[model samples]
Target: MPVVSRFLGIIIAMYWDDHAPPHFHAKYAEYEITVNIRTGVVEGKFPKRALRHVLEWYEIHREELIENWELCQNDESPKSIEPLE
Candidate 1:
C-alpha cells in the first residue's frame, strides 16, 4: 500500500492494482475503513469523528484521488496528497 496522505494520526493509502470503485484505505490505530472516492461512502470500522475527518479530506481531494486511482490501475505509484490540517 502506498500512503497518499496522513494527518491527525490517520493514515490514508491506496494499493497498486486495487479493486474497483476508486477507493482509499484510512487506518487509525486499530480502526480501518475503505472510503469510496466518488461517493464518500465508507466500508469497515472507524471512529465517527475520524471518519468525518477522512470524508472532509476526501472531499477536498476527490480529483487527486481519481487521478491516483488511475495511476494505480496502470500499476504506477500514486502521488502524495495534502492532508487535512
Candidate 2:
C-alpha cells in the first residue's frame, strides 16, 4: 500500500490492483478501515473521532481519491493528497 495522505495521526493509503468497489484505506493507531470511494461505506474499525476526520477528508478529496484509484489500478504511483486541517 502506498500512502496518499496523512492527518491527525491518521494515515491514508491505497493498494495497487486492490479489491473492488473503488476504496481506500484509513489507519489510525491500531485501527484500520477501508472506506468506499463513492459511497463512504467502511469496513473494519476505527475510533469515532478519527473516523469523522477520515470521512471529512474523504468528502474533501473524493475526486482526487478516484483519480488515485485509477492510477493505482494501472500500477502507477499515487499522488499525495492534502491532509485535513
Candidate 3:
C-alpha cells in the first residue's frame, strides 16, 4: 500500500493490484474504511465526523484519486494528494 495523503490524523492509501470499484483506504486511529473514488461510497468503518472530512477531501481530489487508482492497478506507486485543510 502507498500512502497518498495524511492530515488530521487520517491516513489515505491505495494498494497495488487492488480490487475493483477503484477505491482508496482511509485510516484514522482504529477506524479503517475503503472509499470508492468515483462515487464516494465507503466500505468498512469510520467515525461520522472523520468520514465527513474524508468525503470532502475525496470530492476535491476525485480526479486525482482516479488517476492514482489507475496507476495502482498497473502496479505503479500512487502520487501524493493534497490533504484537506
Best by TM-score: 2
Give candidate 2's TM-score: 0.97
Judged by whole-model lDDT over C-alpha atoms, candidate 1 comes out at: 0.94
lDDT of 2 by residue, 1-83 (tens): 79999999999999998989999999999999999999999999998999999999999999999999999999999999999
TM-scores of all predicted structures:
0.96, 0.97, 0.96
- The TM-score of candidate 3 is 0.96
lDDT of 3 by residue, 1-85 (tens): 7999999999999999888989999999999999988778899999999999999999999999999999999989999999999
Residue 37, model 1: lDDT of 88
Q: Compute the lDDT of residue 69 as modeled in candidate 1.
A: 96
Clashes of 1: 0
Error of 2 at 64 (Å): 0.1
lDDT of 3 at 59: 94
Q: Provide the clashing-pair count of each candidate structure.
A: 0, 0, 0
